[model samples]
Target chain A: MAFNILIVDDSKTIRSVIKKTLEIAEIPVGELYEAENGQAGLAVLQENWIDIVFADINMPVMTGIEMIEKMNADNLLEKTPVIIVSTEGSQTRVEELIKKGVRAFIRKPISPETLRNVVNEVMGDYDEGGN
Target chain B: MKEETKDIVYKVCCDVFEHLAFMFGEVLDEDDITSVADTFIKASMSFKGEQQSGIVAIVVPEELSVNLAYEILGLEKSEQIDPDGPEDAVKEVLNTICGRLLPAIFGDSPIFDLTPPETTVISYQEWEELVQGHAYISLEIENNPVLITTSL
Candidate 1:
């Protein structure tokens, strides 16, 4: 089955880059979505069946951490996985994020291989042709 | 800024430019610096931690900003570029640089909160003023001058 993915970042360039990277990595995707901030991300999550979310920590309206907190509070939303794709480098901050229920952490300047690996690790194996 | 800190910032800037933008960068000696451009795109962000709080900024030529956006987006030069693409690209670059830089300077354990990067267009006069007023590092990327400044 194809996975539905949502990307949350304030930078339009970053959102495009992530979308392109996902295509380059050949991840089986269905109904890819984009949001400018965590609030918008939550709105998307509320309206759609997103398999995973890739979000940035620092944003204008709402932060990834805040979004995760809200998700954790919701019984249904907490089940969907979230992976942080940011430039954040502090191990302590990363540990805190993981404890807050983040599924994975991906540093900026992401590569296709890293995206592919993380998706496989989080979503389990899926056929390239969407079998 | 201390010489050691300058060196670290310089190294991190070069690495980020290379990895994030696929652009090669080299530190330019003071004597090697030449003329300033007519305009530049300046991107800046602030970071605060328990032991340290400061701002990191990068200034790039407007022409180079377009190239940066294209390079980062992996777009063909012939394709039409979005008007917001250049500014957004630089902001993201500055954001990533700050994220990597804080840890390099303050160690990985200290948590630093980074503000969302901001960008502005400035004239050559303003660029010269910034260079003269602050201790800034100059880099040569794609044969264009890029400046990095920090205030702690």
Candidate 2:
């Protein structure tokens, strides 16, 4: 089965890389959408049924954290899992993201194996590697 | 002058280079570290945290930049690579690298402040002139030199 996916990042390069990595990993995707910031990501959510959203933490116009908080407040983020894709490496920050109901967090420059593992697990595959 | 700052700078450069190489699958080696070339792709980003405003600069050779553009765009190198279009790419690499480095150096949440990356095409002499007062470290990525200059 294929799933709809949204990628939100301010960097075109990183978005391209993530898309490429997904393709290389052979993740089943029905649609691939991109947004440059949190607001844009929210706009996409209004129109599409996204199974997973990959977002960066910092950006102009809107940030990932703000986006998540807004989505939660508006009740638009229920059931839809968001995974923070950022370079931030702090336990407290990651905990904050977890408290905000993020499904998972992946650091930048993620390997294909890890990327695959995250998506698979979120889709309820329950991969042992992800654990 | 602090050990924390020194460690962060070194790690940032190493991490940024490794990330680029991994993403592009291209070979980046440092050929020369002393002087930059006449043609290069330069990116800059401002860091704002705890009453301090500093800048980070990453400069790569034009050849490498063009190559990276092609790799990024997922097009053949024979295709015309738009030099202007990759400015955002430059900025992004700088932003991520700096964002990660700040906390390591400052031992804080890196403040809620940072600027979008600004990039420009620069000449060797121009870069030399710009580095006069600021502290800098240069790396030879697969023989292609990348100079990182910072003003704190």
Candidate 3:
């Protein structure tokens, strides 16, 4: 089953790079969506059926943490996986995010291999067409 | 800044450029600093940690900025690029560099709050003024001068 993914970042270049990386990694994507910040990401989430979300930490209007908080407040959205794709590298911050329902954290300059591995690890058995 | 700190910033700058844009950079000798181009782009961002707070900035020639954008986007030489591509690319580069540099300097335990990166286009004369006032780490990437500075 192809997964519907949402990418949230302030930089258009980064959003494009992540999309390119997902394509290069050959990850099966059902419907890929883009948002410039966390507020917009939440709007997309509310409007679409997203399997997973890739978000950056620092953004204008709202932050990734804030978006996650909003997601956690909802019953259905809380179950959806969120993997952080950011330049942030603090272990403390990582732990904090994990505690806040973040599935995984990926640093910037992400490689195709890393993305593939993270996807497989987070969405296990999905590769075999399992939801 | 101390020489050791400068060394760390320099190393981080080189590594980020190579990893993010597939561009290799070498440490530029101080004496070799010369006006190679009249136009330049400067990207800067601030960070606040528990014990340290400061700003990190990067300056690159306009020509190099375009190259950075193209390489980062994995575009061909003939492909057209958006006008905002170069500016966005440089800002992202600085953002990545700042993120990595903080961890390298202060370890992974200290969480940092980083401001969104800001960019500006400056003339060579303005660049010269900045060079004279700040202690910056210079690098040569694609034979163009790149500068990184930190203000604590």
Candidate 4:
């Protein structure tokens, strides 16, 4: 079964690349939604169901970490795994995100295999026959 | 701040290009590296450690930058690559490399902070006239040339 996914980043290029990567990787996609920043991402979340979110840590409007913080504070961290896809590779930064309930960290220039692995690992039984 | 800073930067370039080439399914050549800053993509990131501030600027070619982005984002050629992206693809490459490399150079678990990457396009004319004698490292990965310039 395909899953609904949301991608959040300020870069249209990055977003387009991700969408294409998912398609190329043959990840099942029911419906794909995109937001340029955290606020828009949250709005999309409220409006539709998203199984996972691939986000960049650094953004103009609202950062990925800030968004996760808000989500956790509001008890909305459940039901979706937000994997941080970014260039920041500091260990401290990674640990901080882990504490906030982030599923995993995939640094920039991410690979197809890594993306697939993370999605599958996080979604687990929900994917219903892994894509 | 020593004369070896150039060597350090060069080593960093070699190490990073080798790793990136392996990751991108290609091995880079030294001949492909170009020092001409005009065709470079300018990227800057700030690092703070021990009350000392370091800024890393990576100047890369547009095509190479796009290719790196493709490798990073895993996109096909059909997808258009934008030179203007917030992720600062090339800059992020420099930032991550430096962030990892600097500590090893410092030989300590120093608290280093990184800022987001910022990038821009640079023309050859401007590069020759303005960026005079700037320190940069050039490399060829699978015959693809990559350049990096830093201001610390």
lDDT of 1 by residue, A71-124 (tens): 999987986889999999999999999999888999999999999999998876
Candidate 3, B102-148: lDDT as tens digits: 99888999999999999999999999887876578799998998989
In candidate 4, which residue ranges exceed 4 Å CA deviation?
A77-79, A125-131, B1-39, B49-52, B63-92, B95-113, B129-131, B141-145
Worst lDDT 10-window in candidate 1 chain B: B28-37
- CAPRI tier of model 3: high
* Models sorted by lDDT, best on top: 3, 1, 2, 4
Best candidate (score: TM-score): 3
Compute each candidate's TM-score over C-alphas.
Answer: 0.96, 0.81, 0.96, 0.74
DockQ score for candidate 1: 0.87
* Global Cα lDDT for candidate 3: 0.91
Candidate 1 residue spans exceeding 4 A from truth: A125-131
* lDDT, model 4, position B31: 40
For model 4, residues B90-137, the per-residue Cα lDDT tens digits are 765775666656654664445565666677778876444333454555
Calculate DockQ per candidate and list them: 0.87, 0.30, 0.88, 0.22
Candidate 3 wrong stretches, greater than 4 Å: A125-131
lDDT of 3 by residue, A23-54 (tens): 99999999999999989999999999999899
Give candidate 1's total backbone clashes: 0
